[model samples]
Target chain A: MMDDIKELIEEGKFYFLNQKYNEALQYLNKALEKDPANIEVLYTIGIIYESINNPDKALEYFKKVIKIDPQHEDAIIHIHSISENQ
Target chain B: MERFVVIGLGRFGQSVAINLAKLNKNVIAIDKDPQKVEEIADFVFQAAACDATDEKNLRDLGLKNADVGVVSVGEDISSSILITLTLKEMGVKKIISKALSQVQGKVLIKVGADRVIYPERDMGERLAKRLSSPQLFDLIELTESHGILELLAPESFVGKRLDQLELRKKYDVTVIAVKRNVPKLKDDGSTSFKESMILSPGPDFEILLGDIMIILGKSKGLDKIKKVK
Candidate 1:
């Protein structure tokens, strides 16, 4: 099960780095379904939402990451920036 | 070679003084705080710490010969009004004052201010417009009735030729330019987005997704185009 999750995460990261946001999202979502408590997957999905100009969705995911790990520096910063712009 | 007097050393006043001086105009910057005056002394023609509301102090600064006076002390309406009045009485050709509210703006205009500016209100309006229409990049008012605007091409315009749309005849606006981001590879084989512009594209040019259209025409015409699906 862990190997499957790792493979899905690697594929998602590859698509994201290549700017194929939709494919990256599909893989990331599949990985999240397999391992619902993955903090990295949640943060990466938030970044994808932000890049696609959906700040509200981005903030929703970032807030969830903060709830799970209060010391998540990147998520905290993203939430603050998204809130300031809105 | 006209002289400009900026009465206030706040952010707005300092910016006005520095920009005027950069344009090779003679600028006199004044403020009640010595530190503020000293901070900008090197950049302006002259910097003085004096009470701007007092007509005697203005006269002592040789402001009577100034061609323009900008009063940015909007914190106190009384002082802003008094400084504007003193500048008007001093034979300054133009007096521009900052007003905190619409009522204060009216009062300033009534007291011989040639122009009254509301920095905060104007910024708020621009921010609201940009937030409401994410596609609108910029809007510049050229005159009371005309404006130049840059906005992302609406989805309907994609895959259509410019002439086929007959934008000028139908919407009464001219497409001055179109900007697009094309994918390019760098020397290191890294892919990047390169911005390209087609100035005054002819009839055969096809609109593409992610194109930014810069249009120039009456504000009403632009508003009409914006309403198109």
Candidate 2:
């Protein structure tokens, strides 16, 4: 199960780097379902949403990442950025 | 280090003295009010409660040897003029005076002030610009026609490569740098954001949302950029 989750994240990151945001979200969302508290998956999805200018959705994912891991500095920064823009 | 003699412990005078001292420069702050001088005594090299209009007192304080003298006697035109003349006659290298009006500024210049500043008017102008243009984060005026502006990346700029945007040809502006918050993986495996600056981004560089672009261009080009949604 852990291997599957890692593979899903790798696929998501690959698509993300290539600018295939929808494909990246699909893979990342699947990984998130498997491990709801996965920090990497949540952060990547937040990045995807932010890049696409879906700040509200991005904030949602980023907030979830922060709730799970308070030390997620990236998520905290994204939350602040999204809030300020709004 | 340059030595600065600041006369008049008004708000503007106090700020200049404190900032000069903070920069490790020698600052002598003078005011007629003992309370005002006492308030800034801890921050500057020397804070004295003395009448700045007295040339003898100024000469005694070695004002002639200072690199610069700033006269900021708020709302007291005669005192400001007297202080500027005193500093100039004492051979202060440069004299800056604050004025409440153009006429006062002109008089200060005629009385040997090297530069005249209108802090209140400048602050009001900045506030007006910020209120009118929400996208413009900050601006530094380089000349009457040119400036360096910090603004958010417009929506049309996002997802497009720098070369594709043709900003130089279209807007006559040069993108000097891009400020972004980039994600970083810490040694402990936690994720963090690092404030990064990309100086002189290449032609292939793509603009991302949330990026702050610092551009240098003429005022007309900057006004157009500000209007971009």
Compute the interface RMSD for each candidate structure: 6.5, 5.6
List the pairs of residues colliding in candidate 1.
none
Report the C-alpha lDDT of model 2 over A1-86, residue by residue, as the tens digit: 99999999888877766656677789988998999899888887887777655666888999998899998777898899777655
Off by over 4 Å in 2: A1-86, B138-147, B181-195, B217-223
For model 2, residues B47-150, the per-residue Cα lDDT tens digits are 99998888888888887889999999999999999999988888899999999999999999999999999999988887687668656779899999999999
C-alpha root-mean-square deviation, each candidate: 6.0, 7.2
**Model 1, span B11-77: residue lDDT tens:** 9899999999999999999999999999999999999999988889999999998999999985989
Q: Please give me the DockQ of candidate 2 compared with the native complex.
A: 0.10
Compose the digit string of candidate 1's lDDT tens values, residues A23-85: 878998999999888887888788776654456788988998999999988789889987876
For model 2, what is the error of residue B216's alpha carbon versus the real structure, in angstroms, after optimal superposition?
Answer: 3.7
